[model samples]
Target chain A: MKRFRVLDIVLGILGLLTLLWIWHLVTMLELIPRVFLPSPAATIAALEWGLVNGDLLPQTLATINRMIQGWLLASLVAIAVGSLIGVSAIARAYIQPTLEFLRPLPASAIIPVAISIFGLNSSMVLGVVVFGAVWPTLLGTIHGFAHVEPRLVEVSRLLQMSRWEFIYKIGLPNAVPDILAGMRLSLTVALILAVVGELLTAQEGLGTAVLHAARSYRAADLYAGILLLGLIGLVSNYGLAIADKRILAWKN
Target chain B: MAQNAAIELKDVSLSFGSNEILTGIDMSVEPGEFVCVIGASGSGKTTLLRMIAGLLPPTTGAVLLHGKAVRSPTRRVAVVFQDYGRALLPWRRAYANVSLPLEASGMPANQRPARIRQLLAKVGLANHEDKFPGQLSGGMQQRLQIARSLAQEPDTLLMDEPFGALDAMTRQTLQDEVLRLVAERKTTVFFVTHDIEEALYLGDRVVALDSNPGRVAYDIKVPLPRPRDQLTTREHPEFLRLRREMFEIMNKIHA
Candidate 1:
């Protein structure tokens, strides 16, 4: 395990170096116009300017906060409703069709509706992020809870566990791996929707900052914004991966 | 008579829709007696055990326990399932699996540790307490399942082919452990298995069921003496005689 962690860091550095090398090559060769594609040096300077002089820190934090808030809300609600539908036949029958219908519609398609309701605000961005993020977590949870073995169910019954005890002890724990998997997917969706919401709704966030950079033809700022977004995604994913390992240590 | 009976199936019949699984399964188990039911795959042995455990309802007649009709599973009854892999909570360590019933019974937190430890140690799983069910071998997992059931402290133990999946050596070992445990605790056991020899070995009486509208076909008292050894018991004249008779009957039924 220690060897693998070191190997992972080495591989990560190698990947970053390779990406930077490619950016340098593209600019050095003048393969694209300077205005359209920024030099690696220009992008770094833009990153410094954004962090030191611009609102990059606040904008990045704002985008991440919205993502976390929406993702957490979706997780809590989905875990409850998904588990309910997973275990209860009546609930599955009643709620499944609507969920299935709504799940397939793209999260981006709801942007217009959200804008009309909440109107160019943080709430509108949140609504969009939550709507987009809930499906993966909900569906994953249902799948997890539904597939719990019949034998375990019988054991629970034989043990004379109360309704709540059975659900908490057996149902929830059995669904953990799936729930965490869903949460990870939802987190990804949350980030995407957060950006999409800001871009479309003209809200103040990293997404809006990126959109502003692109409109003004500030290619260096655009590259820096995109770089920051990628780093945020990588960090959050790493955090979740660590958590998944710790929580489900018994699995493997 | 009914009050003294640990379990009684009075003309109990069960059907899934129009298809009958068990019919006229009339049997009685006295308190502390071990009864084994043997049959082929579709012979309703498991169905009978389920009825006794109150997990399933009979289409006709009644399943009674301690003079009361068995309607649903109670704390007084516990079951050890055949597929231990599925029966055990993979997320929980062996100790917590045993602690499940104790916790459910609303036993105090402080009281649970001793009981859980005792149950795990009873099943010879003391060293494997921290291991998850997935980490254990099939035999060890089955022992964990047994430990969990024992923690229930049930008056009646219903086992459905609990050792069917284990190898010959593990099967023999578990069989002895079960016999010893049940004998010590004076717990009433209703064991269902496909193996006729196992039925004869562990049971005070062996009940064989016929398939195709499954019903009791034979009921034989195992007059073999107690504290049966793995080798001597198998070699006993009475054991050989009963084995022959049961093998012939089972063959004829399959034919």
Candidate 2:
């Protein structure tokens, strides 16, 4: 098993090298103008320079900060309110239809309303990020809490669990798998919204840097920004996956 | 008889909207007695057990526990469900699963480990406390459920076909284990099973419930000798006679 994992990682790196080779070939041949797509070396150079001298590190931090704040806020609220919607039939009847209707409304579409409310401030961007990232965890929490086994509920009842005890012991633990999956998904959504929010507000983040690079026709810088965002997504997701494995180890 | 009864159902009838599921059911169990109720699939044996556990309320009658009307589940009664897979939380280790009732009852966190260890030891799962329900075999999972039930420290225990899903050999061993455990505790037990021989093997008395509108068809006393061995008692002429009688009654209900 250990050897196979090493082999898998080696093959994955090889695949990445192949993609880079193809990208370099495309740029060298000028299939799409160099003005539009920079060579891999140029992109790599920009990345190095951005980290050493430019705002790359701080902008990356800013975007991550926004994502984490929005995600944490969304998760806390989801667990709280989602339990209500999950456990209470009356709450479900009233809130579920409204949620279903709102679930489909895109987060970007909320930007106009958010701008009207907060007027291009950092809070406006945070609002958009929260709006976008909240759905997956919220719905997942509700589904998880609602689907607890009937027999377990009977066991809980026979034990005479208080309402809080029932939710904590049975409801929350049952919802962990679903909630974790939702949290992973919401992480990606949060990153996207953070970037989008930064771009619209000219916030001091990678999104703003990318926008500035695009308008100035700095193709290498733009590509570098995109590359850095991809790396962020990959690393954050990997971190969450490790947490998921550790928390759900007993599942095995 | 009803005065000192541990559990009593007084003319209990259950209706679902317009559909009557159980009608005119009356039974009383003395403290520390093992009463096994057996019937076919739709016989409302499970419904009766649920009423005793206070999981459901009979539409027309009262389910009383220790002379008090059972409005809802009380901590004094523990239920071991048939679907051990669903009954035990898959996320929880065996120790935590058994700790559920203790946690609900607000046992001090520091005191829980010893109690949990003792309960797991009771069901022969002491070393398997770290295993998850999914990690354990079906029989082990059922034992985990039993251990968890024991943690409730109930005055009465209700089991709905608790061993129906286990293989025959496993079932026999668990039956013997349960009898020994019940012998130690003064807990009144209400066991429901479709298995005829199981009823005779486990119960001091077996109540056969009729289906459609479930009611007691016949209640027979099992005077088979105590400390019943699975091999010897199963071969006992009296055990065989009761088993045959139970089968005949169940067949009549099915017909």
Candidate 3:
């Protein structure tokens, strides 16, 4: 394990160096104008300027807060509804068609409808993100809950576990891996909707930053915003991966 | 006369959809009797055992435990399946697995620890109390399953090819342990297997079941005395004779 970690670190460093080298080459070649494709140094300067002068920190905070609210609310609703449907054939029969119909429709397509219904504010953005994120979570919860081993179910019945005990002990634990996988997918979907929501509807956040930089023809600022978003995505995914490993440590 | 029968199946018939698995099966297990049901694959041996365990309902007739009808798995009956890995809950420790039925029966939490310890020691898994099922070997896992079932202090123990997956040496050792344990506890056991030798070796009565609507082809009494050891029992003339007769019967059924 120690040797593998060392090798991983070395490979990561080499990959970073190669990326920097390519970035330098691309800038020097002037294949695209600097205003359209800024150098890494220029992008860094723009990032610093935004951090110092613009409403970057507050807007970033607002975006994160909205994302958390929407994501969490959607997750709770999905789990409750999905579990109900998973446990009951009639409930699934009634709800499945509606869910399937809505799931395939692009969440962005409903942004205009959200704006009209919730007004041109954070609620609209939240609506979009929640709509996009909930499907994966709901589907995952249903699939996970439904796929619990029949043998385990028999065991639970034989043991005379209460309804709640059956769910909490056998059902939930068995479905956890699937639930986590679904949440990971939902997180990515939430991030995408967050950016799209801000870009299309709001006057602030990282998405708005990209739009403003694009309008002003400031490529360096645009690249900086995009870089920050990418970093956020990488960090969120890494955090989830760590959590998944810890939770499923019992699994072979 | 009726008090001695731990379990009874009268004209028990079982079917899956249109295909009948067991038909007109009549059997009774006396108190503390070790009965082994042996047959070929697809022979309704397992189906019959499951009916007795109350895991499956008979298509027709009744499965009775202590004279009451068995519509579902009774608290006094417990089963140990062949797949030890799948039989145990992975999330629980060895001690927890043993105590699971006690807890389910709503045994007081304060008294659970003592019971778990006693059962673990009985199964020779005292040191493994803290270990999870995944950490145990195939043999150890089987022992854990046995411990868990025995913890229930059941009126009858139902095993479906319990040691069928183990190595020959491990299987032999476990068979000895099981016989010894059953003798000590005086627990009635209804064990099922495809191995003819295993049936003869462990059972007080070896029931040979034939397939195609499975029913008992023959019921042979094993004449070996109690507290029989592996070497001595195998060397006994009666044991050899019974084994050969069972092998022939099984072969004829298969053919």
Q: Candidate 1 regions off by >4 Å?
A: A1-16, A200-202, B1-3
lDDT of 1 by residue, B166-246 (tens): 999999999999999999889999999999889988999999899999999899999999998899999999999999999
State model 1's lDDT. 0.90
Q: Which pairs of residues collide in candidate 3?
A: none
Question: What docking grade does candidate 2 earn?
Answer: high
Q: For residues A1-252, could you state the per-residue lDDT of candidate 1 as single tens digits? A: 899999999999999999899989999999999999999999999999999999998999989999999999999988988888888767777888999899999998888898899888889999988999998889888887777888888887887777678778988888889999999999999999999888877777899999999999999999999999999899999999999999998888
Clashes of each: 0, 0, 0
- Candidate with better TM-score, 2 vs 3: 2
In candidate 3, stretches whose alpha carbon ends up further than 4 angstroms from where it belongs are A1-9, A52-54, A89-94, B93-96, B108-110, B129-131
> How close is candidate 1 at the interface, in terms of C-alpha RMSD after superposing the true interface residues?
1.0
Ordered list by lDDT, greatest first: 1, 2, 3
**Error at A132, model 3, angstroms:** 0.9
